[model samples]
Every structure is written in C-alpha cells, then in structure tokens.
Target: MNHAHSWVHAFQDRLDLAPFGSAGLALFALALKFGYDDVASIGIDAVVDGPDDRSVDLVYVDRDQRLAVVAQSYVANTPKGQAKASKAATLRQALSYLIEVDLESLPERLWPAASDLRSALAEGAIDQLYVWFVHNCPSSRNVSNEIRTVGATVTSMIRAHFENSNIDIFADDISSEVLEQLYTDTNTPILVNDKISFITHTTLSFEEKEWQCVIAPIKLSDLKSLYTSHETRLFSANVRDFLGMKAGDSNINHQMQKTISENPQNFFIYNNGITLLTHGVDVFDVPNGKRIDAHGLSIVNGAQTTGTVGTSEIEPPADAFVLARFISTKSGDLIGDVVRYNNRQNAVTASDFRSTDSIQKQLVDQMKRIPNAEYDGGRRGGVSAAIKRRPNLLPSYSVGQALAAVHGDPTVAYNEKSAIWSKDALYSRYFNEQLTARHVVFCYGLLKAVENEKNELRKREHNHEKLTKADIAKLEFYRKRGAVLLLCAAIGECLETIADRVIANRFSLTFGEKDSPEDAAAYWQPTVKAISGLHAHLEKAFSDGLKNQEKVRETLKNFSQIVATLRAPFAEFFKSVENKLS
Candidate 1:
C-alpha cells in the first residue's frame, strides 16, 4: 500500500539529487508536465527553492502553452498511505504572497520569477496558471480539498492582480498515483486498460500489417461513458488537450453539444466521428452485424467531441450515435506516426514539417552511431521514445537551441527552436553539409556543461552548502535568462585554444567519437570559469539577452586578451581535450 515511484528514484540518481527528495519530485513532475525527455533537458534554474523562497518551490513558464506553473512539492521520508494535506499550505502562502503582492516586495530569490509571471499574466502572454501540490503519496480527499482551496485562492488573486485579463487558473493535487498516470501517458498511447465489447448493426473492417480497423456506430451514451471514465487520458497520444468551449458561438465543442441537444439524429452526419487506438482487437460477425472487443483504449482524435459529450450537463440522447473507428496496433515505431497524422485539431509546428527534411535525415543517421547518445534531429519519437529517461539523449529542440547558440545567435537558440528548424537561412546555418554528429557533440556538450554548472550552483544554494562570496555572485549571474546559452556562445568563441589545437574548422570540431556530452562537458568548464571571471563583461554582453552581436564579440575579444595575458592557466584541461580528440 505504501511504495515509491521507481522513476522518482531514477530522477534522483540520474541528476544525483538524492536527499533533496522534495526537489527531486518537483523536477520529476515538471519533466512530465513539459514533456521533457530527461533530467538534463530541464532548466534547473527554474527552481526557486530555499528557506527564503516564500513557499514557492518552483516557477516554470511555458510561453508556447500560454501557461505558468507555481508548484509546492513534498516527498515523504518514509512510505505512507497518503501524503499530508497540509502541504497545500505552501501553495496557499505562495498565492497570498507571490500572486497578490507587488513584485517589489518579494525576496530577491523569488522576485525574478514573480516578476516574470506577473508580466506574463498582466501582458496577456499567459492564459493558464496552474498551482500544483506534487508529492509522492496517494491522493486523498483531505488533500484534494486543500488543493481546491489553493486553486480558488489563486483564481481570486489572478483577477486582483490582472483586473481585465482573461486567465483561467487551476490547482491540482499531483500525488504519486497521478504522477504515475502522467508517466504512463508518455510511455503509451492508451492508458485505459479495460476490455470492452461493442455491437453494431452495420460495420466495415480493414486490415494492414500489425494493424486493423473496425468501423461501426457507437451510441453517444457509450462514448460519453468512456470519456467520463478517463477524461484526458483518453487523448494521451493526442497533440492537444480538449480546448474547452470558449466564449464564442463558433467553438467546436459548443457546436457539438448543441447539435446533440437540438438535432440528436443528425449528430452522426453533422459531426466528425472518433478514432480509438487500442492495444488489441478481436472481431466476430454477429446475427445483426458485428461485435468487437478491444483493450487498452485511447482516443487519438475527436477529443473535443468526446470531451464535450462527457462534460455535457444534460444526458446525451439514447437514439443518437457517432461513427467510431477502432484501430489496433502493437508497433511503437508506427503508432507515433499514427498519432501525429490523425490529430487534425492541433496546429502542426514548424518542427513537424522539418522532420522530413533531407538534412534532418542525415543528422539523425550520424547521431545514431554514437554510443549512449540519441538525437532525433526533428521528431523525438513522440509517445514511444519518452517512456524512459536517457540522460545523454539529445532531443531535437535542445540540439537546435545548442547549435543556434554556438553557431551565432544565442537569442534565437534560447527562444526560437521552431524558427531554427523552420527558417531556411537559420536551418542551413546549423544543419548544412559541413555539420557532422561530432560537431554537435562539441556544441551540445558545451551547452550541457553550462546547464550543469547552473544546476550545481543552485543545488548548493538550496542545500545551504557553504559558498564563497564570489561563488554566490556567479550563481546570480547564471540566473539570468539566456545566460547559459550566452555563456555557451562565449565558450564556443575560444574552442581552438581550449582544444589546444589550431582548429581550422570550428564546425568540424568534436570531443572524439565515443565521448558522451556529460564527459565532454568537462573540457568546457575551464573556459566557462575563465569567461565568467569577468563578471562585468558578462553583464554588459548578456544583461539584455545577447541583443547586440557586436557587443558580445567585443566581450569575447576582451576575454581573449585577458587569457593571453594570463597565458591561459588551463593547460592541464586543454591537454585533456587534445588527448580526447579523434
């Protein structure tokens, strides 16, 4: 009855964040929430946790989703039947302080995050704010009530903070069970494991390799029941969630519900049918038509239709029916495509369109040759590949961002992954014929190093480990937006010296054939230290997020002169880099 998620322990060990149990859970939940493939992929600087953190453990903003999350997490010292309900007090305090109060009054550590969130909310950059109480214990009604209070309080505060802003805020109790379900959604397309049979008077069947589909009519009542049972889990593989009916007459969910009420019999013709992906299916002809049994069900499409029916206040008419297609497949490689192609509701991003580009294919092939590393180039294998964590796995977005930073533009790399893959000029700059997997290892490894150092500094800060005054100043500098990528770009400027060789071509540089990013990151550390030593240069170049390329180049030139004057005291590490080169 009392057990811990193995994945939580995995996150702890992978990031080596043991003993910081609550922080580990926070990272775990955020990774799932954001579809981050590994602990390394997460930006640890988002953690605003410390004694002075004002009950805000983490604050993560997703501009793409128009969402901001303020989370308070707890990890039990011992296994318990349920998590403490009182943990919600932490979120309550956050709502009262961070949301309701002016940003100027916040503690220095929290002020930056609070300010970012405030700007997002007030400027209408964000429309959804989530307050999550995440813990590694079973959920209880007691805690659920507390979570509700937290949600209500945050909702009230949002209005007070942004009087005319249209932001919908929610509070969620992300207990261990809920966390597991979110994890399951990433690993598989379907989470509902119930085996159920369907009967229809008219039906058609089609077959293909490792897949088959049964087309039939499904009663609206039955469809609603399935949705009511699983909710968003039914659309686990869907590209987007049910974008509930908004304040407009043209909203699809609104139309679907109205059709069901005003024209029950015409529902099938007027509305698009649903597609259900399943683990297995068995079909047999009955006296009237066909009977089919399916297991492990999820709706790949028609989430809006199903959600509208499920959430409808009035019961769906018994006579109404919706056309349904049940597709059965066990192939992971193909299901990702199935999910991607079937989701017509969501806007396909530029990354999706670029996944098929000829350059991406070559990069994908080159990356696969390296051991203990995987790069999708563009497509990250969707739901199938996210089942497990690979700390060294370089997903498409990270690679794009890293390449963009080291090549030239830290601003694009830090903010425009879509633009990198979508824009022809930008795509060619990073993914041209001159680029190789080895070069990616070089740039990506340096970026990983930057991220790791930022995390290490914050870990020590949160753990209350002793830090010298200078070290604390360094941590503060690393906290700035685009700072890690900015530093990565800084280090890339001196790759030739750091490699301790006259490298003619920077794009061809690599840490060697077998070196993983984690190991290769060590070579970049001395450079990071050297450049970061000149805090004034860093502030001048990065204070506004690498806006002026000439200013950044001047900063690097100054850094180079300082290194030459010091004779580059990092000969020992530079020698290591020289030795590792293939």
Candidate 2:
C-alpha cells in the first residue's frame, strides 16, 4: 500500500478505540500534519444523547493566531453520494447550533471546551473563529454550495453577536488522491529572473556536487508567492522564525513595511536581501540575461522581510526588488554549517539554542522519572506526550516559571515575564545539574497547592456574596498577590531549611532516595504539615491586606517592592515554624 493508504488502514484499525470513530483520527492526523499542538478531541457525542451531535468533535485554540477552531469530522466508507448528504446534514446542524445556543448553556460534557471558546470570544482574546468540516469522502458540487451558504449564515450570526470579530468557515475533504499528493515529495521548477531558472532535485550527481552560486534580482511578488504557497514549511530549516510586526511602532517589520509602502522602487536599497540554501543549481545563458535553476530551496536569512511582504495588509509595490543569493550544496554537513553561519550573524536567545543542550535532555529524562510528572523540554512530541500522560501537571512553559520561582527570583514569576529565563545570564545561573528534576517537581507541587488554596478561598468568598463589587475586585487582587507571595515565601523557606540536607543526602522530601511509592506517604507528611501551617499565616496576611486595601494595592503595583515586603514576613513565619518544630 502507498503512504496515504497505509495511513487510512492504520486509522481504520484504531477506529474502535476512537470515541468519534475514523473522523476523530482524521482530525488528529490533520492537526499533527499542520504542526498544531494542544489539540483536544472533545467527545461531545458520547456523553450527550440527542438526535445527533449538535457540537463540534474537535476544538483547538491557537494562542499565536488568537483564533479558536471548531471542527466536525465526517468519515465515510460507503458511496460518495450518501457520504456527501450525511456530511452536509451534520455540517448544517453543527453550524446552526453554534449560532443559536449561548455557549454557557451547553451540556456538561461539552461545557469545558465551549466555556473556553466563549471566554475567548467574550474577552476579545481571540480575533477570529474558524468553523471547519473535515471529511474523507468527496463532497458533491451542490453539497459544497450548501456548505458555503450555511457557513455564510453562521458567520453573519456570529458577527451580529460580536462587534469586532471575524469568522471563517472551511470544508476540507481528505480524499485518497489528495492524501497521496500530500504524502508524495514532488519538486517543481522555479523561475528566478528573465535569465534565471531553478528546478528541485531529489538526488545530485558527482559532477553536480561542486558548489554553485547565483546572484539575481528577484521580484518581491515572486518571493511572496513562494511564501504563500509553502507557508512556514519554507522556513522550517531556518534558525529564526518570522517575528511578525508588533501592534505598536517598535518592531522592525513594521518599520520595513512602512518604508516599502512609501517607496516601492527604493525597497531594494532600504532592505537587506535574502540568503537561500539549495541542494542543486544549474546556470545557463539567455539572450537578455542568465538563467539559474535551483532545487530544494530554503531561505536561510531575511525571513522577516519575506513574511512582512507576503502577509502585510498593504500590498508590496510592483517596482520593489530584492537581491537573492542562491548557494548550492549536496552535503548535509555543509548545509548545517551554512545554517549556523547565517544565523550567528544575528543575536540569538538562549531558548533558541536549547535543543542541542545536554542539560535540557538530562532534565527531560529526569522529569519523566517523576511519578505523574511529565516534561518534554518544550518539544512538540514531548508536550503532546506529557499532556496525554499527565494532564494535571503544569504546562511545559511553566518549567521556566517554576525554575525562576524556586531560584529566589519570584519577581519574574509575579510579573509573568519570560524574558529573564530566556536570557543566557539568568538561565545559565539556575538551569544546571545542581537543580534536578526532583526540585522542579517539588516546586511545582508547592505552586499547585498555593493555586488550590487561592481557588478555595475565592469560592468561599463568592458563596458568602456579602462583599460589594469594589470589595470583590479588591479581594481578587489580594488573592492573586497572596498566592504569589505565599508560593515564593514557601520556596525560600524550603531552600533555606531543607535544600542543603536533601542535596547532601541525595534524597527528596516528597520522594525518598529509592523513589518508591511506599516512601511517598512518609515523605509528604511533614511537607504537607508545613504547607498547611504556612497557609494559615498566608490567609492572615491576605486578611490584613484586605483591611488596608489602598496600601496593599499601592505596594502590589511595584513588583520588586512586593517581593521585598513579603520577604521579612515570610522569613519570620518560617523561623516561627522552625522554632515550633524544634
């Protein structure tokens, strides 16, 4: 069987285990193919019984795009006509229900995902909503038009509800033919200039192994076309991603776009040209100019320029020009060198170079050993595996936050900024062999406990319903501040009181030396008691802050001062506990 057929067979075998059958598998496969993470296959149909499912089968919220995608999958093994009709009916019902129902009123099984979608919509956290119909069978022409019409109706309803929101609906049929094409690696020839031509190559001859270079003036529109056709995969090999233009006026892409808009003819002079890596290239002479055909082309530099020009709302000028240098190499070793050389020209963050770090790998391995703890070092597969195995563990991004918090830099955690951890200076200090995965797991537990305490306190206060709106707002503020202060104070106390002994003994308070389940109960006993004692004092601190709301508010405004103010009290609290224990 071909690659496409193999995929189908594999999915077919797993259909019994899949809650939504083959459709769910197809959605998951599509999500994986597109590099989307954090995909949740919400089995709304299994729990809620109705005429049919009036809810989407899959929901994924893209934080980068600020978009929520709700997808319904239709997998059919029967005749095309019957499949098309069935898919159309399912699509129409799902869209209509989305338009008619308030998300908050959704059934309990669907409530969590629906609540997330609704929250994003209500808070303006998302800019767009994508309603997608994914299917394996081919859709008829009439059914296609029907799908578009239903989509339009739903879009109108959503727009009427949300004043400044955009909604787009898409129907994709993952037919055998389409899947075959997707799986096949076919290279197409590209036209560089009047005299230059580029063709893709799967293999290179011994004679063609020599490096060939070409310098040409390529049109901005052509570059944009390539970017549009390939999307992110075009720059997949590049070290840096296209950092899109920021909303304000501080970004380089913003400035470059402005310049291009103002002077189309002078863009070549204003912007640096892109450097590209290719597997093979051929040079030929033409009447007016030279022709260069290149294979396996990827932009090694100038991703920002290409991204801005291609995706910018303002169209690039017709007269705008960019210089393109094509370097051909057959050796994989040479390709690596080229990538490193080009990327090193610009300043890169420690996070960018983390993939090759030995410490990161060690940390990931250590984290995996922790019971019910998952770590993937932020890789795609790692993150997916971690989430699947231990959904309750902190997200991969929280690794850095936990690190900073435990390392006595709670200011960074309080401010919720990742810059300090991404920088070499601070990351090098804390992320070392000295800090084991056990330390991370312990710190994460403390943070989770504090979060749980805050939630319980909030729920208790809400149940009372005695506070005014202003007072309630003040209480919420205090709750957040109290959680951070308590967590930081607890981490400081743990380090001061226990870290040395634990390190010297090669033992953890949460897990003993053997890392056995039997030792966990004994290990966590005192730790739990310490946390409980700290919680009472933290509650008292919160109560005092609530009594002096104005003073707490002013103090909390400065994150540095808040950390400083909490330190002495936290220290005193720890000392009192130590004295009591003695």
Candidate 3:
C-alpha cells in the first residue's frame, strides 16, 4: 500500500540506511507490504510477570542501560504474521542475535539499532562485561533479592574461574615469568554485605577481605517505569510535545507546537522527561466550541517568546488521521515488536527442549532428510562435528573444570575477557556463607549454656556429687562466687570490656574462696581461645566459605541440631542464679 511505503521511506532516512534498494529487496517485498502499518508503530500486547502465560511470545532485552521490552499474542497469528511482528529478546538471545545479524545490510529489519537510540546504556557507562542472570530464592522474603543474588553469583563465578586458571592452566600455557608479575599486581579480594545487597573485590595479599553491601526497599514498578519509559521515548517528537504539558490546560494548547518541536520522542517516553503520552488522545477541550483529541493533529514546540493566550489550537483532522500519521512518522511500534519476538524466542529456546528426546533421536531426525554424503561428513568429524563439541568447552558443562579454564595465560599480562571468575563458583561461595553464619551464631550460644551447667555440678553440696549438709553449705558459698566470675567473663566476651572497674569487679565478686592469682591467670588463656576460635571460623567462611552449597548446608544443619540437643540440660544448669544471698 502507498501508506506502508511512506513509512519505509521515513525510516530509511532516519536510520541512515538505503531505501530497500538491494538485490534481495524483492524476496522481502510481501513482508514489507503487509506489515508496514503495524510494525511502523509497535506497542506491547501484554505485560507479563513471568513465563507461564500462553500470550507471551517475545521479549526485548536492553543492554547494560537498564531497559528491556517484551510482548505476547494469542497463538492464532500465522508464520508471516509472526515474522512481521517484533518480539522481546532476552539478554542471552540478544547477544546471539547481535553476533549473527549484520546491522548494515538489514537496517529496516533491525531498525532502532542499538546505537541510533538514546538509552541508559550510554548513560550508565557500563563498558565492562555486562551480566544478566536468573536464579531461585529459597525464602521469598524479597523478590528483588533474587536479582542481587544473581549478580553476586555471576561475580564469584568469574573470580573462581580466573583464579584457578591463573594458578593452573594459564600458567603453563603462557610464559611463567609474565604470569607471576600479573599475580603480584592484583589485590586481596574483598566482599561486603548489607542486608539487601553486596559487592566483592580482591587484592593479591590474603590479609584482610572486605565487602560492601547495601539493603534498601525498592518498588519494582519504579525501576521498570524508570528504564522502560526512557527507552520508549527515545525516537518520537509528537509524543514528546504531548508530555511536556505541566497541566492539561488552555495555555499548553497555545504553545503545543513549541513543545512537540522541542521534544520529539514524546511518541515514546525517553530521558525520564516525557513518560506518559500517546497519540490520538485528547489535547484540548473546547466544551461548547470544538473538542480536540490526540489523533487529530501532532503538537510541535514553540520558539517565540510571545504566544497566543487562548489554546492556539491547530486543527489536524480525526483520530484515525493522527494514528495514521504516527505510524507514518515513527518506528517505535516496529522496534518494540522486534524486542518482543526476541524475548519469546529466547524463553522457548532456552527451556530444556532435550527433556523428552535422546540426542541420538534428535540427530537421526535432523539427518533423515540430508543426503548420505552430508551425513557421512558429520560422522567423519567435519565442520558440523566441531560445532557439536563447542558446548563441551563452555564452563557450565563441568563447573569444577571451568574453575581451571578461566584464567588466561598467567605468564602474560591480564586479558580482561574470559579470565575472570566463572559464574557458578561465585554464586556458590556467597550463598553458603550466609547459611553458615546463621548456624554458627546459634551453636555458639548453646556451647556457653553447656559450660554453665558443668560448673554448677562442681560445687553443689548434695552427697550425690560430694559432701554432707554443713560441708555442702560451705561448698555452696564458693560455688556462688565462682558463678559470678564466670558470668562476668561471658558478659565481657559477649559485649565489650572497657577500662572501668566493672570488668575486674565482676570477676573479683565471685571469688568465694581465696585462691592463688596463678589460678585465675591459668583460666584466661582457654576462655580467650574459645571466643577467638568462634569469631575466626565464622569470619573466614564469610570470606571464602564453602563453594559447594549442598556440603555447606549439610554441615550447618548438623551443627544446629547438635546445639539444639544440648540446650535442655544447659538451660536447667543456668536456671539457678547463684544462691549467694541465701
């Protein structure tokens, strides 16, 4: 149609691409003819929270910039209909497409090229490797915590993968002398955790590990709108003008032309500036006069200082005309569709398709139609055979070996690419530590309870343990003094001990029977050691901890059960306050 052709012409200039003047132009002519109107002005068909809905078929994954788009439609659409409609692409899918698709030749197909559009990708300045991860949360306290855990997991995976290679494979593969120099330059790693989020870094020295963590309550809606709107508003001017109005009033109408001219992407929300606006919507109300809606005409910004007082309304036409114009002038709809399709394809593709079929069965089906010669080539290990083996080289195939593969030649200068920790190891380390810390704190409390009951048994005057009533009474007095001293030690260890007399007084008050100073000095070492050991174990695990989750959980569960079992007798023993007054 002539209408669709206009769009094709408009975008060719906008994208700095040639008008469909190519050898393959005829092959795609039918697609362009049918989809020209709808693809020219794309929009999300539905908003999905997850993957289960039948409507969702495509997703858009924006790069490091914090923007993403996805869409879904009912299953009835045809194969050609599917091609014309754009879908959302997941990060993994986007990466693959980016590598496979040639941007130069297919400008109309991949319009809104990553660079042509304005996005947080440029704003955030995320030049380093970009990571997107999916995960499961054991307890659903905070859904966003899932995002934080994924990030940490990816970081650890990278570090471990690199560390092993630096020590093993890369060292032998590259010049040894260069490897040592590179190792010396890196710092001991640090990991910090706030309740909600954490970051980790490392240095060469092992002395101290540091972590930076943050915890905040964030609304998911705020994040989605913040980034999504910015990305959408990047390419349209008519939408921009509609958004600049401070209040829907007469004055805005007078200056409407100026607003649209100033901010073109109003058609889509970009720059966090014009977030909510759409074409073919009402712009001004005449009440008794004439009511003007969005579709009738487009608004442009004003340059002149002097302006008309009344809504200097310019009449365009009807809603359909405006809709037609929007589709004519902008490619937002098409780009959004592409993003949606990408996501749908990604979700379906990434799913475990091999679940029902064996690899041999799949190979047989794939080879059935191929000529015997082609099958023979594959059997003999030709190009197709090499492709099959590539997955084996990926780190996920065997996480343990992946640990050794990430380090680039330690002998050479650091290569920024694959030489970082693998994703699996990093996730394993942090998840294990948090679980272990909770277990240790619980056990430490139980140990002290057990100690208290044993001390109680030592001085009880009952003949079951020692002497008669009178002798027992005397022993009781000493037991009371000793109990007080122990309590002081617990407090000093549990809390802090200042330079005041309280620390020494707590111990002195409990000395029921006079004893040599040497006796008190002898007890100090063991008590300090116990407290020190508890702190060290917890801290070290918090640093590197256990990388394998199953092993760590099993260990923690055993420790917690042991401590809980000891609680009964220990509670009874401490149930007696010293009978000093009696």
Query: Residue-wise lDDT of candidate 3 within 365-423, one digit each (tens)?
Result: 43343222011110111111211212111111111111121111111101111112223
> What lDDT is obtained when candidate 1 is compared to the true structure?
0.73
Cα lDDT tens digits, model 1, 1-582, are: 234565554444444343234665776776665555543444454667677888787787666556778888777766476777776766888877776777678777777677667767877877678789888778899999999988887777777768977766768998888887777667766778899788777778899878889888988888888778778878887766676776557566788888877888899999779888988888888996678788878888888888888888778877798999988887887787778668633222356667887877887788777767777767756543543556667877778888887876776776566667767888888888888888888788877777777777777877789999888888777766567877777666666666656767678777777777777788776556655665556577764445577887777667655555554666664565667776
Name the top lDDT candidate. 1
Q: State candidate 2's TM-score.
A: 0.52
lDDT of 3: 0.23
- State the displacement of the C-alpha of residue 128, model 2, in Å, after optimal TM-score superposition: 5.1
Candidate scoring better on lDDT of 2 and 3: 2
- Give model 1's clash tally: 0
- Candidate RMSDs in Å, in order, are 3.9, 11.2, 32.0
Which candidate model has the greater TM-score, 1 or 3? 1
Which of the predicted structures, 1 or 3, would earn the higher lDDT when compared with the native?
1
